[model samples]
Target: MNDKFELPPRRRLPDEIRQRMRTRVWEGLGEPDQRPRWTVTVRGRAPIAVAAAVVVLVAGGVTLLQSVQGGGGQPTAGGQATTTRPSQQLGPLLVPGVAQSAVDKCQAVAFAQTTPGDYAEPDRWRPRFSVSLPGREVAVFDAAGPVFCELTRTTVTVSPAVAAPQVLDVSAPASAARVTSLFQTANHTLAGTVDSQVTGLELGLANADGSNGVLGRAALMDGVFVANLPLSERGAAQGGRLLLSATTPTGTLTGSGPVPDGRVWQGTTVDVWPSGDSDPTSRRNQLDRCLDRALVNGLPGTDAEGWQPGARVGSAADQEGVLVAHRDDGQLVACALADQHGAELQLATRIFAPDRTANPDVPVTAVDLSWRFLTVWGAVGPRVARVELVGENTTATGEVVDGTFAVQLAGVTDAAGWETRNVLRAFDAAGNLLYEGTPVIRR
Candidate 1:
């Protein structure tokens, strides 16, 4: 963050809290992004959710209101630029910068013109940074941040972008995330930025058998990294999945997201293989779209507390998705569910939390939810080694990972008869019986 934008001593928030809020808002903007904006190596920050999103909307609203008033705005036909000088308004110029004539064209495009919606015309926009690449990237920014990205072949403009001083965060040292589509170039490629600590990078596609396939190392310069993608390697199925990774001293950080079409990122395709690798990372990675929704849409008060991604329990075309999310701390366990609407899994319904304890020797609480579907999922005791679903026409084992436990069930079973159709038996490592009971059928 630029320190020029920092609050005056009299108006400043606590340094720590203010930092967290800024991180959350910037990271939260990544609803469609596949990689995390911040790292979880230490796990101090919370994922941005509905609340942080509201902050962004509200900020935009403030800009709208200010713009409507006599506040500063871009130069209209006869209007003059704000008296605020240009140099104070931008970040550093990227190395191998574009020619001044192109920069002059960018300066002509008002900052307000670059962004969509009615925003107060910035005092002025200047070219904080300019990069000459196949993707002509220009940063038209005010101290607030990059106002908008001009990815076109020509342009130059600077705004009050880098006037602020920043407090360096030494604990985590670096943060990374996938760039949004607004700046995507025509060539099939993925783009991201990195700090000096990220010395090397590797990007690849998740394979059919849960192995990794190299897409080629990313090309980095001026804090930006762009990797050419093999278009043939990406498809609508299980094999061609591209994932994100950044290398640091501790270890390599990795992430997955929807496929990039050189235009827009595609939603992950999902499928289940109960008969396959017990559980494949590829299946879980694809189903992550469901888990990602938990960060943005999950509401504990509404019972949709699911977060971590897991293997898809059923077929992808059918559209239903299920994952058991165990909280980082071992106190509670819950299910995250998304239902089939058409060809894909829809935003998950709110009724997700089982809200039960999963301690040693505790009985696993099975709960049945969804009136339209017969879904049986619930808590798994920490010490319990296995949970088997017995009764019905056949016996099936729940996929238990860490403190989570979930199984796929056909909606063909009668909701009224689910309790009698299946019983859950949990056992410890010694195969000693922890407890057994029918599901707590939901309304």
Candidate 2:
């Protein structure tokens, strides 16, 4: 009876079919009791239950296969297929806190790339980070342009990108008009107020043909800047313009203009000496004695008493003598004696007041002296043509050159421990006294 009730034929399932069945079972669709059942009749065998069972198993396998293949797992919030990849694999999403972390990372990277000695400070730079919505790809970028670092869920890239520094404004020497003493060589002091943002300032003097020559640097103090740029003799002879440049982290700003021949004296005269109660004649006599002593000790033709009247001196028409001295208003007055052939003896004496109160119009600005030379700078009247330095032992004279008087002391010596007093005098073309002052010298 079992042989008579046997199935017509039995065939083994293919490997692909078996795998599909296993996949469906794993997907929770092919449960034993939930599978469908069917009835099948074979042609030669009695009403066979085996055929019906095989048909039922095949129908259940087909339904389970469709469920596994057609309906796959949904994606995760990070845009990654949950079925294929775990949620943790998709890197952390960019939250506000994460953005800050990215900024810190970028800053570290930037510091590593920069030289240690660079003046730029890392804290001064402001940083910004990119953001992304949930369930989307999250990426990390550098704080600034030329992105150096990029971080993703599964990859990281490093590339150099440099951003320009922040620019700052320069407010000093607002215009070419603020430059002072642009052309005057004697008092070459350039001063102006600069913007607080400026870090460096420089003054350049170039020829009109755009050739570079002299450069002066300025220092900023309490928002004020001052530069003393004394041009060389060659530089002054060549006409040029003044350029004022300011530098910041961002860029450089320049202000330029034609050099002007500024006035010798621009402001009111300052009195450098105070009034005193000394008599003029007494002071002059003392100075005369000092000169007589120097002449007797240093000169060859003079005796202890110095040149005197009726003495067998040189045959020149002008018999020189050290005359009596006096003092007027704390100033020293000494005479240079000149006995002409026919005219009476003339004493060419000049009064020297240390203070500028002697003549406000002609103010001494600078006085430079060495062992055997003297240079005087002043705003003497325009009519003055010669400047002289009268000392105890010798007289040094100089002509106006570029608004200054430089002279070499012919008879002076650099004897150590020997202190001497000298006076500066100015004269016009007619030998008329214009200005005189006692020059302060450091032995």
TM-score, per-candidate, Cα-based: 0.33, 0.23
The predictions' CA RMSDs to the true structure, in order, are: 21.4, 49.2
Model 1: per-residue Cα lDDT over 22-73, one tens digit each: 4565454454333222211101112212111122122222111101212111
* Candidate closest to the true structure, highest lDDT: 1
**Which stretch of 10 consecutive residues in model 2 shows the poorest summed lDDT?**
342-351
Candidate lDDT (C-alpha), each: 0.40, 0.36
Candidate 2 lands at a TM-score of 0.23
| Residue 195 lDDT, candidate 2, scale 0-100 | 55
92-131: candidate 2 lDDT, tens digit per residue:
2223223555555545554565556332354544432232
lDDT of 1: 0.40
Which portions of model 1 show Cα errors greater than 4 Å? Answer: 1-291, 296-312, 315-319, 331-360, 364-373, 414-417, 429-432, 441-443
Off by over 4 Å in 2: 1-186, 231-238, 271-443
Error of 1 at 256 (Å): 38
Error of 2 at 348 (Å): 27
